[model samples]
Structure formats: structure tokens, C-alpha cells
Target chain A: MDLDLDAATLDFRGEVRGWLAEHVPRPGLPSMDTAEGFAAHREWEATLARARLSVVTWPREYTGREASLVQWLVFEEEYYAAGAPGRVSQNGIFMLAPTLFAHGTAEQRDRILPAMARGEQVWAQAWSEPEAGSDIAALRSRAERTDGGWLLSGQKTWSSRAAFADRAFGLFRSDPSSSRHHGLTYFMIDLRADGVTVRPIPQLDGEPGFAEIFLDEVFVPDADVIGEPGNGWRVAMTTANNERGLSLRSPGRFLAAADRLVDLWRQRGEPEWAAERVADAWIGARAYQLYTYGTATRLAEGGQLGPESSVNKLYWSHLDLGLHETALDLLGADGELAGPWTDGYLFALAGPIYGGTDQIQRNTIAERLLGLPREAR
Target chain B: MRFTPSPEQRQFAASLHDLLSGADTPGAVRAWAEGRPEPGLKLWRDLADLGVTALRVPEECDGLGAGLTDLVIAFEVLGYHAVPGPLAESVAVAPALLGDGERLRALAAGRLLATVALPPHVPYALDADVAGLVLLVENGAVYRGEPETEPVRSVDAARRLFRVAGTGGALGATDGSAFEAGVLAVAAELLGAGQRLLDEAAAYARQRHQYGRPIGSYQALKHLLADVVTRLELARPLVHGAAVTATARDVSAAKAAAGEAAYLAARAALQVHGAIGYTAEHHLGLWLTRVRALTGAWGGGAYHRARVLAGA
Candidate 1:
């Protein structure tokens, strides 16, 4: 019946706050707008790694401190409060790392886990081929049988971070004709293969966080396959479920930014409309936090991912985009003058498109959760 | 963290469902409200007998001492049975007027059936006449008043509304949190009504046929039903969250979220029922009527949205 954290959890939060205050890098450490920012953030992560606080939910065997879920949430709250770097290797560590621990073979785990834990290896996703983004089972990449191995040949577009990745985890169709999500295998392929090519795609913000990867006759040893061949569908489903399940972005980040926006507007003594917009933005930010906090509490209690996560994702995306849009709007004509607000607004447009589109999430909720019949596309 | 209702709550909800379904169909409700003429005595007695009117009063005052969660169960049952009365308003708004032991005892005994006498445009004003007094709230102030007009007919045929001319005792200056609580209560009722509509629509679609197949088996109608279910799912958490927050005295965000959930539920219910729902013969229309009344009952969805947008 009560919504407040427990006394012990509150104490834990205070401890985290005090620790973060002492350890967080000083302002001007880096920004998120450029490669230098990304590198600087990596350095910050390495520092946290040294302190054994990064990724608190990972087991102690994985070089983690094995904190409780509540402590994990508290850590995140403090981490975001302290302006820690956004985890650049989230696709690798947050999504794949967990799955590798659970379903991966001993060899696979031995090869992947430590490098991921240490941030020594950067991983990219090869899940979404151009034709296979939403209908992921329809992946066209082929991995044919070869002497003591498999030869891979195909293309994966929107392969996030492929340009900077050392390796990739991908689902490939083992039998070229087995298209309805069967006879496929999940493989870990080295990005430095002789015939591989990675080309960065300029996004709306002209950032190259996205890349198109071409796999041309790349050989992967049989040992690299994580599970039974044809079990790729299951493996990929597990991966996606983990990906969506673990995606936890709180409103604190946006709230911090929005607070800064408000301070800027207020300090400048701008229009009264700007005050109203700031208030509106704050409301949206707080609403999102409440929803996310609810989700976090659920996960802390060992709850599985459900339709409601879509609700959270859908809500936060819309709220984040809305607040940023408001920020841009409040800046008026000057808001479109290529400043922070304008760039943020453009970035917000990608919110609905990334992870999964809002429409797609609704469809998932409808078809999978609500048991709705699929719409003929 | 747990989202499921408790066993006791479930049991009480089941009992309520049985009582309400057996005793308070739409026709029966309308007939009773219109036939009773003992200055609200019969209605009050009936509510007490059903334990409906005594839910929120403290146990020390001969009441059930139940909070918003229990009230929510009662409301869902009431909505399901189309119980036409001030079940929500009396329980939600009466406590605001109970200043001393005498007033508290009267409310606990169901001698008082209070309604929030918000204006015609206010959505939850439909249950006004059953109350001995109507509490009106505006801009975080409370003004207890009498109705300026008789109860106006509502689409649900379960309740009526009236306009209050803004003249009554100042119910003491304090934050209008109670009124906000009432609004959140209406949102809970709306959640129930929306869920009922969704369930009914789903059942009907499963039985109703088109081209020799159940309409629900068709993609178009299935997705429509799914959309309604999604709205129901989304609204459920918001309503529950609001009730939790309301008990904790955190009203602003919950109120806003509840308002949106109720408003969306109403709209989605109407869309699901299509033309049949627009007609009065079907109960879907009745729920829609209730939804419209509830959506505006507090401060209207727009006001709550604005409040929410203003960062409660």
C-alpha cells in the first residue's frame, strides 16, 4: 500500500549519494555530443569498474559486487544523479552479457564474459537486417556448412556500433530456404574477418552510432555457435526479451536536463510562457519517473518482462520527446538555431523510431499480450 | 511491487458483485432512485445495509474503516451491475463535511448521502441528489453548497446532475485534496466501466458472426478489442497507482494519470461498441454515459491533464 522506499533502502540511498558525491568526475569531464565525449565517458566507466560498482546486478563471478536489486536501483538513481556516463556498451553488457551467462556454452562464456566485464571488448548487434527488423525471424543472412566450420555471407543493417565493435552476435539462416524461423544458428563473429566491411550511417543528428555490416564469406568455427542450430529463434527471442526487459532509462537524466533548461530560462528572465513550458516539462518528467520506478520495483521483486514494459517504454519515449520538443519550442525561433534544445528535439524524433517504434510496441501489446489477431500487413 | 489484488479484496469484490448484480440492474436502479421519496432515507438505509455508505468512515464511528482500495472494489462491482446511486460520491466527498462527532456518526450510519455538487460541465456531478449536502471545490478551495437546480437526466440513467450556485458555508480553508480524491475515485469507477465494456465487447465479438466466423476471429475486430484491452491494462495500473498515492497524500500526479486513464477508457469503450454503443438500448452506452460524467466529474480530463502537465 505504501510507495516510499524502506528505511534501510533509504539509508542505502544516502550512502550511495555520499559515495557518488565523492567519486563522480567534476563537471567538464566530458559531454555526450561527440566521439571525445564517448571516449571520456569510457574512461569514467573504467574508473567505476576499478571501484567495483559498475553493473551492480552482475554476479560476483562476473567481477561484479553482487548487490541486491534495491541496491541496484539505488545505485542507478545515484549514478544518474551524479551525471555518470551513459553506458556505451549497453548492447553488449546489459543485453548480451546476461544471456551469454545463462544460455551460452562454457567456452562461449569463457571467451565473452570477462572481456565484456572489463570493457576490453566492444560488441555490436547483428540482429536487425534491413528486411528483418520487426519480423526478426525473417533474417536472410546465410551461414553454410564448411570444413570444420560455417561460412557466413549476407548483410546486417542498423547494426548498432558495428563500426566500433570488435565482435558481433548474430542470428543467421543455416539453411538458405528455411525462412520461417527455423534451421538458423546464433554465431559470434569477429568483426576483423578478411572480407567483412562496416559502413557508418549518418543519423538525424549526423552521429554514426549506427552502421551497416557486410559479412562476405566470413568463417565461424562450429565452436562459436552458442546453442543448437535451429535454436537461434529461441536464442534470439531470449536476447530480444532480455534487451527489452533490461532497457531501464529513468526520467532523472531528462529531469536533470530539464532542470538545467529551466534554470537557463529563469536566469535569463524569458517569457512567462517559458515558465509554463518548464513546469509542463517537469510534470512529464515526474510522471515518467513514477512509472519507471514502479517498473523497477517490479523487476526488483523478480518479476518477468510483460506488456506493461511497453507501456513504460512508450510513455517515457513520448515524454522525453515531448519535453525536448517543448524545450525547443520555448526557445522559439532561436530554438531552431542549432543549439542544445534544437539538437535535442531532433534527437527526440528518433526516440519513437529506436528500440522499437511506438506503433510496433502497441502492436506487440495487442498481439502478444492482449491476444489480438495479427493485422494483415 | 505486487500488482495483483489481495484475497480479502478479491473476496469482498466477489460478494459485492453478487449483491449488486442481483439487486441493482440499470432498470432496477433507475426505478429505485425515482420511486424513493423519503428525503433520501430509503437510499441511505439501503446503502448502510449493503455496507456501501459505511466504507470510508472510521471503525470507531461504526463504519467499515475501509480505504480507497476497498472503495475501488465496491465501485467496480457497482459499475458492473450498473448500480445507479451515489456510492462513490457519498463515500468520497462526505468525509470532507464531517467536522465533528455528530456529522461523522450521521455519515457512518448512512443518515447522510453526500454528493459533490460540481457544475453541469463537471463529469462526476451525476450523483448529486442523493446527498443531503453537495461539496463544491475550485482552485484548491472548498465551498459546501446546495444545488441551484434539480438533478438533470444523465445518459447512464443510473445517476443525475445539478448546478450549484456557489453559495454555502466555507468548509474551512485547506488544500482541495479531498476533491482531488473524489476525482481519483471517479477515475477508478471509469476504469471499472472501461474494463466492463472491454470484456463485454470481447464476449460479443466472440459470439457475433461475420462471414460465418466469429467477428473476434477477424483481424480488424480483434485488434480493436486488443486496443481496448491495452487501454484497460494501461488504465488499471494508473488507477491503482493513484489509489495508492491518494492514501499516501500524493494526489497531483496520480489524479492526472487517473483522469487520462478514465478519459481514454471512455473513448476507447465507445469506439469498441461502434454504433450499437451510441444507442441507449445497450449497456455500453450506459457505461459511456457514466464515463462522460466521471471524466468531467472532478475537474474534467483537460484540467487534470493540465495539472499533470504542470508537473504535480
Candidate 2:
């Protein structure tokens, strides 16, 4: 009911805002949609990591300031408000951190958490196979049991950042005889190992952030297996939940975009009607902020992941796309051809497809959230 | 940094839910909205007692002064209930009219009812013989008017609309601010109506079995329902944010954005509900009518869009 931040939180916002004003990266870096852009993004993350300002939500034990979730959100808002590149290693900060904290052994956590926090390593998700995108449980990547280790073999497509990643966390079929969901095992495998091949996929935007990985007899020590054997689905679910639920976009970023868009709309000799669309976009952005706050609140309250997280994914992806679309619409022909808006528009299209498609998110909502009966074959 | 409602807000919202759950029942809302003789006195009085009628009014004015955020919560509940009344305008818009203490007190007491009239459609608008005041904007001047007609039947059977003939006693407030707030109020109300339609469709999707399973499970219905929910979520925040920032150093952006969100939510809601949603006997059509009325109720989305563009 109350949207106003308290005095302390507001003060925290001011501090974060002040920090971002100085540290935002320069303009000559690679564009975010391109491979070079991701490299630049990583460099920016390393710079922030050096300052100990990146990924504020994790505990201080892991090189984080151990800031509260509210402060973390403020950090994001301020960071985005400053036009800084998004965290380059989000697969590390947002996804892997939570997964390792929950399931990794203490020694594993000690080894990975600090290094990941300091940007010493980059992680890619090796989940989706050529045939198993939505039905992730049907993964055919094999991990054979061995003395004190496991041997991994098979391919993982849509392996974001795998082309340059130091390591990957993947799910593999460890037992050929077990059921589809039960035979899976989760492992953190070094991408530099022998017999690992990574080839980047060329996207429309010419980004090589996504790659396909072919593993032939790659070895992973049993110590790197996350959780128990056959527990990969549960661990991967935890990762996916973090991917969908806890990840967020700062409202200030969109607000800043709206500010620029309003300027762009008027500069083109357009009428004031575009301002309303901008305002609508602002509303969508603000709503997304509120939605993220709700998710964070649940996490603070120790709530478990539920179907409502799908609602969050479904809602925000469309919101992100809609705001950019409105920006493009306002720009008319100019928006379609050039500038940040065009790139944003293209990137936004992937919002629904990545993480989970809007269709799949809705299915989750229907079957799980609403408890509707499953579709009859 | 956090944008969601707090625990306290949730509790306050629950109060609204509890009160409006009965007041906004589909039947009652339809009865009054179509200008049927139902006054909805019981629900109104209950709301007044619960401090909803005076939520946005300043405490110095013998009201709660909970501000727009509180009003957002109240109206969202009202929308959820689909209570066919000018509750948002009466509470959010009337305070700006500078009406006499008696009128404000009556409004706060749930004994008085008020609604704002813009252009293009005027029903039994001047018929305030049974109510405390009628707020109308004419020739760009906001006037407190009195009408001689009774509440008349309309496409939306749950709301009462009156047609005013002449401007009554001037309440002395000529500022366009109140009028703009009234428009935004309608927008917020429409946001609520859209949500109601979405809920109806979702519920129906769960119960309406097809091919031996809930229709919601089918791709066709799933996509439709998902689209409706997406639109609803998109619009809900816009409306709420507009309310939050309406008193901003600049208000046009919020109003314009809210105007679009309102219309879009209602439109998508109707689309999701399909045929049964269009019937007069059902609450879906009632929401559709309210949305239609509210779409152009004030300056409208097009006009507001222009305003926003001008601001930009």
C-alpha cells in the first residue's frame, strides 16, 4: 500500500546513486548485443567487483557487503539509473550464487563464492540440449559414474557465454536405466577441460553470448557434483527459480530511457501525444519495480518458490518488451532504424523466449498456479 | 528501492477486500450501474463506516487523509467488487470541489453521493435532489450543479448516471485540477473493472470443461487467459503509479498513462471473456460498458497522449 521508501532506505538510495555517478563505463566499449559488448560488460563487472560494489545481496563472507535485499534493489536502481551495463556475469551472481549456497558443500562454497564474487571466473548454464529446451528434464547429456569422479559427454545448446566461459553448471543423465527426471545429475564442470568444444551461435544482433557446447569425455571430480546423485532436477530447479524470480531490472533504467525517449519524441517534430505513451511506459516500469519488490519480500520472509514466480517472469518480460515497443512506436521510422531503441527492441523480443517462453510461463500459471487440469492429449 | 506493498498496506488492502466483497457483488453492481432503483445504501454505509468513503480526504476535513496510495487500495478493492458507483470520483475528485462542510461531511458519512460529468454523455446528471452535490465541468468551468431528473437506465446497469440541465450553486472551485483527478479516478476505476473481467474469465476457464478438461488447460484458452492476465498486470501498475504521482510537480504524464492502461485493460478483459462476457446478465459486459464510458469519460487516452507528448 505504501510506496514511499523509509528514511534509511532513501538514504541508501542516495549513497548508491552517488557511487554510480562516478563509475559508469565509457561509451567506446562493444555494444551489449555483440560478443565484444559482453566482453566489455565483463570488464565493467570486474571494475565494480574490485571496488566491492558488485552483487551486494550476498553475505560479506563471500566478498559481498552483505547488504539487505532492499539495499541491493537500491543498488540496482541506482546502477541502472546511471546507465551502467548490467552485471555481465549474472549467471554467476544471480543464478549460481544461490544454487551453491543452497546445495554446495561448505568447501565448494568457500572455493567458488569468493572467486565468483570477485569476477575471477565466469559461469555458463549448460542446461538446454538441441531437443530439450522447455522439457529440460529430458536432457540426454550423459555423466557416467567413475571412481572419485564422473565422465561427462553430450552437447548443450543455448549455452550462454560458454564460448568464453571458465566453467559451466549443467545437468546430465547419470544413470541410463533411471526415469527421465530421476537419472539426472548436476555438475560444475570446467569448460577448459580436454574434449570440450564451444562454438558461438550468431544471433540477429550478431551477439555470440549464446554458444553450443559439445563435451566428449570431459572429467568432473565427484567433489564438484552439486547435491546428491539424481538430485540434479531439484538443484537445476533452484537455479531456474533464481533465474526467473530473483533477477530484476531497475526501474530507474526505464525511467532514464523514458526521459531520453520523451526528448527524442519531441525532437522529431512529433506531437505531445507521445508523452502519454511514455507515461504508460513509465507506469509499466514502475509496476515491474513493485512486482520485484513483492518477490524480494517473499524471499525475505523465507517463502519457497511457487507458481507465482512464473507470473513474475510472464509479467516483467512483456512489460520490458512493451516499454521498448512504445519507445519505438513513438520514434516512428527513426526508432525502427537507429539508436538505442532499435537494439532495445530486438533485445526485448528475446525476453519471452529466454528463461522461459511466455507460453510456457502461462502453462505454469495455468497448471500450477491456478491448479487447472492438464491438457488432454 | 522496493516497490511492492508492505505488510501494513496488505492488511489495509484486506479491509478493503472484506468490505467491497459484498458491496461489489456482480448482482448489486449491475442493479445500480444500469440505473435500476437500487441505491446500494447498505454497502455505501458499510464503506463509510470502514473509512473508505473518506480515505483520500484530509484528516483536518474530518476524513482519513490516507492519500492516493490508500485510495488506490480502496478503489482496487472496489474494482475487484465491481461496485457500480462513482466511489473513486466521489472520494478522490469531490475533495477538490471546495464544497461546504455539510457536503463533505455527508460524503464522509456515506449519506451523500457525487459524480463528475465531462462531455459527450450526460444522463440524469443534474438529478441530485436525493444526493448532496453534482460536480460538472462545463465550458471549462467546474461548477457544482443540481439536476431535476432521476437516475436513468444505462448500458451499465450497475452505475447511476444523471443528466444535468443547468449549473447549480457554484461551489467556487474552477480549477481543472479536480476535473483531471476525476478523469484519472475513472481510469483507476476502469483498471479495477478490467481486473474483475480477468478474474471472471480465469474462473470460467477453470470450470468450463472442454474436451474433458478445464478449458484453461487448452492452448487456445491458455493463450487467451494469459493475454488477459498480461494486460491486466500491465495496466494495474500504470493506474497505481498514476495515482501515486498524480500530485507530482507535473501530473499530465501520470493521467495520460493511466487513461491508456484503463482502456487497454478493459478491452483485453472483454476479449478474453468472449461471448458470455458480453451478456447483460453477466458482469463482464457491465465492465465493458464502464470502460467504454470511462475511456472517453474525461479528456481520454488520445487527448492525454497528446498532453504527454506536449509535456515531453
Candidate 3:
């Protein structure tokens, strides 16, 4: 239980820290949501990929160091502590890439991963639609088999980065007769194709962070199909689990936010009321960090990811909200002003709503983890 | 760097669970709370035989030379059962404060129950009347003490505190180890109690029907308990991490998190149990009140959060 990193792990941490201290941008690039910010973040990803730092845990053949999970956590801590650029390729690296490793064809990994890692190609998740937000299996997107591929047509809303991303992945009903999860096929579609139209949506902070991706008979090669036809639900679960769990949201981000909050409070005279909140922010992040450490340990011991990922999602989503709220309160009059804390507060508002709402996570935990009676949905 | 408990630690917890399951701990707690410690005393001896008390004592002291991590495993089980007595004092603080003297030997053998009064932090000795040994800790100075007045009643009946007056010169210096151990023990206990409360609440939600369905099926209640589960889940690792490090900051972090988490669990459990949980006869109150009592037993949220800030 001791936090005794071995010599090798310590050396790895030191190397990452040194690299980040040296290569991280002087002033971090803008958020990867707007056009200018998006291009700048993509360039930053190129810088990281050139150094094999863009995807630390990915296989070395795909522009990564093949770092261990523990090292990846260390990399994250150092990365956030340095105030590095936002991961412009996170949709690809964190979400789709894991699914690719788990279910993609060997050729798919070889073709997609390097470009994704290098930011030459960026990916957007087209998981949600107007009617199939949380109930993703109720998607109406359809794919028709073609000579060497499939023709995809769907209106996918809340497709992050789709406005600028080169490609997107989602589930489309392949068999017209099948309803719900049965007939769906996971397919990667080119956002720049002939019939694809992206409508950028302004988020709360008024940034084009999310977009509605409309595909009208968009062409997707058979090579892009993941798993098998009628198996998109299970394949997407691989991505869904990664999105909600340790991969998408690391403890480092919260730890960094908590540290900044503490600094903000101290700079603001540390009001007695907000003092406890400030301290709790730090404690909450530390607990989550320690909790992740436990998760990493279990994964190292040959344990597979289980329903506990929902636990991670539930814990961090609220911690993020509460931490940002405290920071805003510390800002007082300035809280209403548009700044980092305000922006973060707005962004944190969606933590519980995205990556499977905390409500759904609760259902998963109750039924899957606790063995409670399933809800009569 | 591994954070999961060892297999042996897991086995130890299971064994303790088995013993406590059969011990009818709710009855023991009820007896102890009513100022009758006989059943609780028997439970204590049984735990002692299982090496709970001897975990911290040195090998030379005729005890298992185990670490705070091991003590945390034992204390968590003890807390899950809500076992009564001066546990933090006898099992954690005493061995860390005292040398392997007659008193330490007696504690390791479960023949003596100790209570401590560390002024400013722990101003009143819990269960001082029932304990066989009472010590006052002022600054770094330690001394044998006696109760200056009758038992001071707590909201939780088992917590019978007493103001103690030192009877002799400082017996020894506290050396700070005892306080850390005590705080760690209480943190683990709170985590265990929180887990039990969540478990009971979930079970009740499953069986107790309302509006033509089990209450557990309601998203409202499920989300409520889900949040509780997350807190307890995260809090346990903090307790374990504190046990691993034993730093002032780490211990206080554990205490603050576990204290708040367990308190939240108690509130949610009460909410889930509804009216029946409010009754004196319902065993849920035992854990509910115990959580309330132990929240400030070593250091409350405000105090521990302050420590966390100061330490950071």
C-alpha cells in the first residue's frame, strides 16, 4: 500500500517531468474547441507525437513509448502539472484507440493509429443523436452494404470535434429488421465526404466544442468496420467504458484544478467559509488519485476493468463540479466574469451529463455491481 | 506501489467478518451502550484471540509485529461490526505511546482496556470508567490519570467520556506516534461504518416496497445510494493510503474524507430506511449514532481539513 515508486518508475517519472518542463508550451495553447484553438492544439499534438509523447501507452510502432499504465499516470500528472495543451486527439487516443486495440482489425490499427497519433487525422465520437442520447442503442442511423464498403446515413448530434475532425465513428443499423442493439454495425465515416455536413454548436462558454454531424449516404469502407455486423453495441461498450473510466478523465486534471483552487483561495485571503471547501477540493482530488492508483494496481494484477469504472465516473464528475464551484466562489465578484474559473465552471456543468450520465452510471452500479433488482425500464 | 490489500489481509478480514457475523454484534453494542459491557467484553476477548489487539505490538512484546496497514484491516472489520470498547485507545494509541511495559503487555493480551485524554485534541477520555487504564496526554507529556468526575454522557451512549487529572509526573513523552495511530484507526472505522451503512441501506431499498415497487428500483434512491457508494469507495483507499504513509497530512486527509463520507452515508441510510430507521430498537441507529460520535472522536472534519490545508 506504500506509495513507494521503484527506481525504474521514479526514473520514468523524472524523465516525463523533465520532458514536460522542457517541451510544454510557454503559454499553453487555447482550448481545442474553436477553429483557431483547434488548429493550434493539433499542431501541439504534432509536437508531442514527434517526441513519442502524444500517446504514451500506445504501442511503440504507433508513435508511442509503450509506457506502462503506472507510467501513463505519472505522465498525466506531469503533463497537467506543466499546464500542457489540451489533448486535441483525445477522442481518437483515449476513446476510439482503445476500442481499436480491443476490436479493430490489425490493418485498421496500423493505418489509423499513426495518423491519429500524429494529429494528421483527428477523430470525433458520433455516439449520440436527437432521440438516442443516453439510450444509444436506440440509434436510427443506418448503413447499407455496398461493393467494397458500407453507405452510412445518420444525424449524430453532440459529435465532439466533428466540425473540424477528419473522421468520426458510430453505430448504424445494418439490418433493417433489427431494433435496439441487435443490427447495429460500428463504422468509421469520413467527415469531409461528399454528403457529410457538420453544424458546429456553441457550448455554454460560446465555443464550437460540439457539433451535429449529419451524414447522408456517406461512404465508409468495409476496412473501417469494427468487430462484426450486429455487434456494434458490445464493441461500443469498449469505448464507452474507456470514455467513462480512467482513460478519458485522469486524476491529474482534478489534481491540477484543485491545486489552482487552493492557490486562488490563498491569494484571495482564504475566507473562513471557503477555506474548508478549498481543503476539501484538494482532499477530494487526492482521494480520486489514490483511488486510481488502486485501480492501476488491480489492473497490474491481471484484473479486468469491471463496473468499478462507473464508480470512477461517479466520483470524479461531482468532484470536478464541486472543485470548480469552490474556485468560482473564491473569485467572488470576478466569478461572473468570463475567465478560466468561469469557463471551467461552465464546462464542469456537463461532467455529469456526458460520457453516460451519472444517472445511467448509477443504474449500472446498482444492478451490475451491487446485484440489486433491476429497474423496470 | 500496489494499493490492493494482500491475500492474507483479505483472509484476515474474512475471518473477522465470520466471527463478527456470529457474535450478534448488534446485541453486544446494545448492551455496551446501556452501560453493560459484559457481552461486548466477551467480543473484545474473542477479537483479541484473533490477533486484533496484538497487531501493533512488537515481536519482542509477545505480539504480532504488524504494521499500521494490518491494524487498519483489523480496525475496519471492528468498525463494520460496531464493536464496543476503548478501541482506538487500547488497540492503537496505547501500544504506540507506551513501551513494552506491564501495561503494554496487558493490552496485547486483552487483559487491560485503556482510555486516553490528550488535551486540546482529545480533552475527555472515552469510556474512562469502564477502561482499566487511563492516561492523560498534555503537549508531549504523558501521565497516569483517574477520572475526576462521573461519566459524561454522549449522544452515542457507548461514548462515556471523563475528564481526567494526572496522578503523577509525566509517565513518558507521547512522541506523536500514538496520535497518528489513533487518527488512522478512527478513519478506518469510519470507512467501514460507511460501507456497512451503504450495504444496509441498499438491502432495505431492495426489500422495502413503496408505491407498488421496491424503493431500490427508483432512480432517485439508486442515485442517492450510488453517490454514497462512490464516497465510501473513494474514502476506503484514502484510509488505506493514510495507513500506508502515516504522515500527518495523509492521516488528516483520511480522517476528513472518511468522516464526511461516513456522515453522508448515515444521513442517506436514514433517509432510505425512513421512519423505521428512526426508532431506538432498529439496529441502524447503532451505526448511525456511532458514525456521528466517531466523526469527531479523533478529529472532526473542520479540524482535519485545517490540518490538511496547513500540512499542504
CA lDDT, every model vs. true structure: 0.66, 0.69, 0.89
Docking class of 1: acceptable
Number of colliding residue pairs in model 1: 8
Candidate 3, residues A46-65, lDDT tens digits: the string is: 98998888998998999998
Candidate number with the higher lDDT (2 or 3): 3
Error in Å for residue A271 of model 1:
6.8
- Model 1, residue A286: C-alpha shift (Å): 4.0
lDDT of 3 by residue, B180-253 (tens): 99999999998889889999999999999988989998888888888888888999888999999888988999
**TM score of chain A per candidate:** 0.87, 0.93, 0.98
For model 2, what TM-score is found for chain B?
0.84
Off by over 4 Å in 3: none
Instruction: Indicate which candidate wins on DockQ.
Output: 3
Give a tens-digit lDDT track for model 1, residues B1-312: 344456688888787776655553655554644745353344347657778777877788787888776776667666665556675667766675456566667777878767665443353454555567677755545677667566667655556666665575566553655665566666667767767766666666656666776666565665455555544554555556666667322344444444455456566656656788777666676666776666655665445544553443
lDDT-based ranking: 3, 2, 1
